[model samples]
Target: MGDKAAGGIPHYYLYGDQEADVELDLLHIEPIRERSGPNDWRIRPHAHPDHMQVLLVKSGGGGIRMEDRQLPIPAPGILVVPAGVVHQIDFDPGTDGFAVTAALGCLRTASAGDPRLATAAGRPAVYPLAGTGLDIPAVIDTFHWLHREFIWSAPGRRTAILAQYMRILVVVLRLSIAHQDAGTATPDRDYDLLVRYRALLEEHFRSQRSLGFFAGELAVTPARLNAACKARSGKTASELLYERIVIEAKRYLVYTESTVAQVAHLTGFDDPAYFNRFFTQRVGISPGAFRKQAARSEG
Candidate 1:
């Protein structure tokens, strides 16, 4: 069971239980072919609960699966798998690449104080290194350097290796966010407000659903807050708040055994009936039905 996937999705410590006897905070680097070729170039659906992974595809192509979604992995690409995300990959025969698996705590430490970095470290994504406004060669070089340091630990090697690891993460974070924003530049003040508002929402969505309260905390009027959200995302502030709550509701329903009433209470709804109505209106399905459908899909 240790090597097997939990719920049919393998739980791994660098593809197996290698970390079971070692320190939890460490990094492992190796060629993709080392593990994939021997296994027919296909990695089964699995997750690393305490680690995050970065795969650099130098040549050839493949497909990456993050939960129910499939993504392409072209040559000179990067795939990031955050901790606890079920993922799998299929590489073309003879595909060449490198993979780095690091402890999640190490990444969290590196990403601290940077919201964008923290966000990137919390999601699974694939990015094409070419034409991404990122320094492709430099990133590849850093990966190579880290691989060397990992294998040939010399004086100050651990610090050097982690510094390179942090560099790769910073580059990946910038490109990921830039791709999401799609080059749509926002004014500094508007962007700052949006970021702060989102951070606050993440913290208080379960207890505070009032748009006015959020705006007041940010020292802005409700109207101005709504305007900023609209200008940046084409959605009003209230819509965003409702969407966040709904998202959390869905996550709880899908990932946990929480009943409708429990989920309602967890998502700021004092009345189960009102929570049911709100979820049905926005999601077009009752919470119980949604959970059942999700279960069937997973099965």
Candidate 2:
């Protein structure tokens, strides 16, 4: 019943699936080959809302399609990918480097003083070292040390890992300042609330909870919740939930051999007739038709 398994983006866990270490804040470091080699060197479009990824490219060439921008990943390039940026990475075959994924908001959470570190690290900056004679091997050396620290845990192991991270960030910050390759770094006041709301919405979207219910859970008024959502994502709170439901419905239609009624029931619609109308209005096709179309396309 599925064709290309429609509905939503495919989640690519840069960090291997496992129980993350709490002391390290889920920090993970691996060779880029280990992460992307099996996938034919193509990373699909996805966002890490709860993770920051740093790609250190030593050889080969590729590019990253970040939202509307396509930036080249030169040999000896360093890319700092902040949280919540939808990006797809395509690497030339035989690309060499390391991929580091670390804690959520670790880049932005600063300890007093001038918080420009947050601004510098928060932006999705790219530094191509092919043409520019930037002789900063310290960054590369630190990544290696960080990978070793991640592999073995001894006394001050966590401290060493974070120290390496600091060194890498220091280098990244200097490069960012020199090149001023600061990508769109939007600082939204309600973004934190929106992130919290999105987490809660994922848990209760199937229940079709009202805006007031979400507001109650988040300790905010319904209006404030909707306003925050609108300000951050340009979608109201209810719209986000509706989009999630539609995505789930599409997944069922494409992946499962379920009838339209079953799909509707699973998506929280008790009445099949109303569900048909809701799906049709939003997706411009009936559940049965979508499944059939997907089949045709896949065939």
Candidate 3:
């Protein structure tokens, strides 16, 4: 393992089976830390442009930090972090766990072979893996095999490792579905909402801002949907919906040279004044000022 200091943090690039310094090429797996102390494990916020990771915590507890949200560590569970999601993990300082990371292409190939596996593209994918004891052993076996292949780092090892990774993905999907059927798993309301709502908002946030529009499509009353959202997240359904809209506005303001009126129209606002007030209320800055600041920072 090679120790490289990246931005004041020590990265112990440890590989038990392969030569160290082999940059993360498409897919990789490694043990972050073994059982050590109550607060022994720590990782600063990080983002991977083209990599996704799956974390399996066999024991101990901690928390996972995702974009603007924090999820309590569900020990003995599995976690998936898709690409482009800013995240970090803090385990019971002495916690023991292992994580596997693979490129998006690798995930697709794995999913292509098995209809049971689910593929989440361009979004943070987090799933709990502890409910089905039936599939647990198989998942573990596949996980270890991938890790070993990574460590062995022999010629043409990636092809074999990728195959094993796909097999585990299939087992995990089946186990999750079976657990849901048996009512042993907690309702994945937030995840289900995130996937479905995000897609709807992408298509309709411009023409519709009413919560009722989305609630109706989900076959739940607005109040019911609001409660489910509030239970999973502190935010109400409307608040979450508006948050997504505001986020889009910010992105346009920072990345485009569009005028305020152009931006307002693009984000579904009929009036520039209304859009300005909305943006300022949520972001604490006027759209024009925000754009200028971002430009200056980039420059």
Candidate 4:
């Protein structure tokens, strides 16, 4: 579904097949290309909770900044930005590329090996794929097959196409995991603290939205935690918390048939009215309206 219903953060363009239990979304600068002018192509800081993205550089140059890392892509390189990482991208003039996004549920179910991957959910592992002649072509071919199948094939063929797509991801995953293990080193204290806080938020975003609560769990002062997040992501701790809440709310709104009041409760909002107001202020649309719009587009 190319159409987007506003809410969470970046408006995802969803793609689906009948066989897959979960959908995939690809986001780029195309939706706003005209307003971007000739030299500008960029996606502002945003995150996706349920999907991971693979950015393939077709031509030109750009860079993506995630957490503490700012990687410059001078040539063709495949960049994987995992779900829920506060990240952004900037493109040079005439830059051409396609971002291949996949839902985590589909990926885990599709992939055979690696018990560790299930535990390391929602974090992106960026990789350079172009220089390697062997794996790069296969990965690109698989992505192309998925795109072609999604567009031309009938519903009956969706399952087969989805299976093929999963196979592609397995290869990518193996390469990524191997790279990480080979270069594995202990992260610094700030990185450790950031990871700890993210894990806490994943587990406790429902009942606890307190930065102090997370800080207490991590054995650090709230100010220190805030500084860590700020230094790493350029977003305050409170902003991160709100971003999580909003992402969950968006998932519920799009995937489930939940009422506005029900979604508020599911996402830790006590009052539906306040939730509606907050969502509108942040997303520029009411909860009910957003849901209806997304549903209409998907349908």
Candidate 5:
């Protein structure tokens, strides 16, 4: 009955018709179980008006259904549910964490002048943090501080709360970008493998490393690497390396006054003519032609 909708969806500060706590207009922090435990560990479809939620899942696992996508949120994870987006969560019994609800105005304040923070908060995202070298106890302590600062009339309480909130978001954004190249941006094994592969690729893409060498570095077979790149990036492992090379070649060609032969050599090719053939085969035109086309488009 707490449903507030112009379109039949429920709007709630928590899961039901609980009135907003006057003090939480800037933000509120509470244990995850306090509300969800009472609600059988399942938050039914609902949205918060002018508010967003960051679920710091310290333990337990479950899936959240946001809009049309349902993703699993394992322990040592973070969920950013943007304001006014309809969402539902079904957690395992004994699931634990803190739910920090903050107003949109507060987000704007925390993110002032930095749209990356705003952009990170502006969507519904689930990030897996296990094995990502996150400091779990430190994160827990951070939230504990948020809860404490939120509850008491301490010195600089508002400033402290906002600073903590902004700090948490910047970490999330970095992890997300690190996953994706800022990309291949999803939570899964293949995406994880792809993320690792891209990181290695970035370091070694300029040199002539065989797919097996890259795979060996990642402790996977070439087949596994190919499978991951194909699944998350829609390209094979070898293709990805080539794609990296082609990208560098294009950059040198379009951005610099370098000759195609010099660009080819810079990209690790010994023969400019061979580089021409390679670029032509991949790009449907030679490097020279592509550069001219880019220049025309810019002009």
Candidate 6:
């Protein structure tokens, strides 16, 4: 098990160096023990640049590390790791669960036309299934069906598997929102605005970076938008926009084979030089250096 770079985060294709034949838009499912058992039930800190993971813990408990936050994972819980979020896990010896990894593109497609699902797919969260509005047994059964279809290819298996995956996502989103709403005292209307802002950010963060544009689209002034975001998340609207852009830039730099200039263009930066400065200012490293560090870690 290789550790993270000396001063940089480790980028992983999956748990360890195991290669996954992940297509642009597809899904893969497997048991929790399959990958964790051989490694003493500990997964080191790593980020999946182009993939998202949902871990359903059926029994036992564990610790989950997501960037700066460390959370406990109790039995009968679901943890969603969105693309590019660094996470690590350590489970009790007998922890039983299923981990489903799906391409970000596929999740976007699955979440199309549904703002709640789209928002859930982009954010990382954990939902304890015991008291949430989710049907625990049904969700587990759906995960089992997905795993079966993934390993045993039958007629129309792809379609069936994807359908099951979507079902699971819907349930997870429902529970996730419920858990969030129950814990927060934010007004419903304010929360709804935040959700809509996030969905809009996901859609237009690339080409639209102006705070005024987002605020106008939401039918509010820039001050109102910033106030709502700050009241809910303690960050201004522009901060959130920049954070999303930086995340996308890092994802492209680490996962894709595109050149720095090309990556800048792809990430909506017209001037490659300006993009380099922006990335360095926010990420503490230049784009080329970041890519090289990721390559060294993978190597």
TM-score: the better of candidates 4 and 5:
4
For each candidate, C-alpha RMSD in Å? 14.0, 13.2, 12.3, 8.4, 16.1, 9.2
lDDT of 5 at 213: 92
lDDT of candidate 5 over 160-182, digit per residue (tens): 99888887777677666745532
Error of 1 at 131 (Å): 1.1
Task: Encode model 3's per-residue lDDT on 88-136: one tens digit a residue.
Answer: 6778765556777775446655776564464532334344566555566
Per-model TM-score on C-alpha atoms: 0.59, 0.58, 0.49, 0.57, 0.57, 0.60
lDDT (Cα, tens digit) per residue for candidate 6, span 212-288: 89999999999988876654444578877887787778778877999999989998999999999998997788999
lDDT of each: 0.77, 0.71, 0.63, 0.60, 0.75, 0.76
Worst 10 residues of 5 by lDDT: 178-187
Q: Considering every candidate listed, which one attains the maximal TM-score?
A: 6
Could you say which candidate leads in lDDT? Answer: 1
Q: Which wins on TM-score, candidate 5 or candidate 6?
A: 6
| Per-residue C-alpha lDDT of model 2 across residues 143-173, encoded as one tens digit per residue | 8999999899677896788778776776666
Q: In candidate 6, which residue ranges exceed 4 Å CA deviation?
A: 1-6, 18-22, 181-299
Off by over 4 Å in 4: 1-115, 118-137, 149-169, 177-192
Ranked by lDDT from best down, the candidates are 1, 6, 5, 2, 3, 4
Error of 1 at 109 (Å): 2.2
Query: How many residue pairs clash (N, CA or C atoms closer than 3 angstroms) in each of the candidate models, in the order given?
Result: 2, 1, 12, 1, 2, 0
Cα lDDT for residue 3, candidate 3: 29
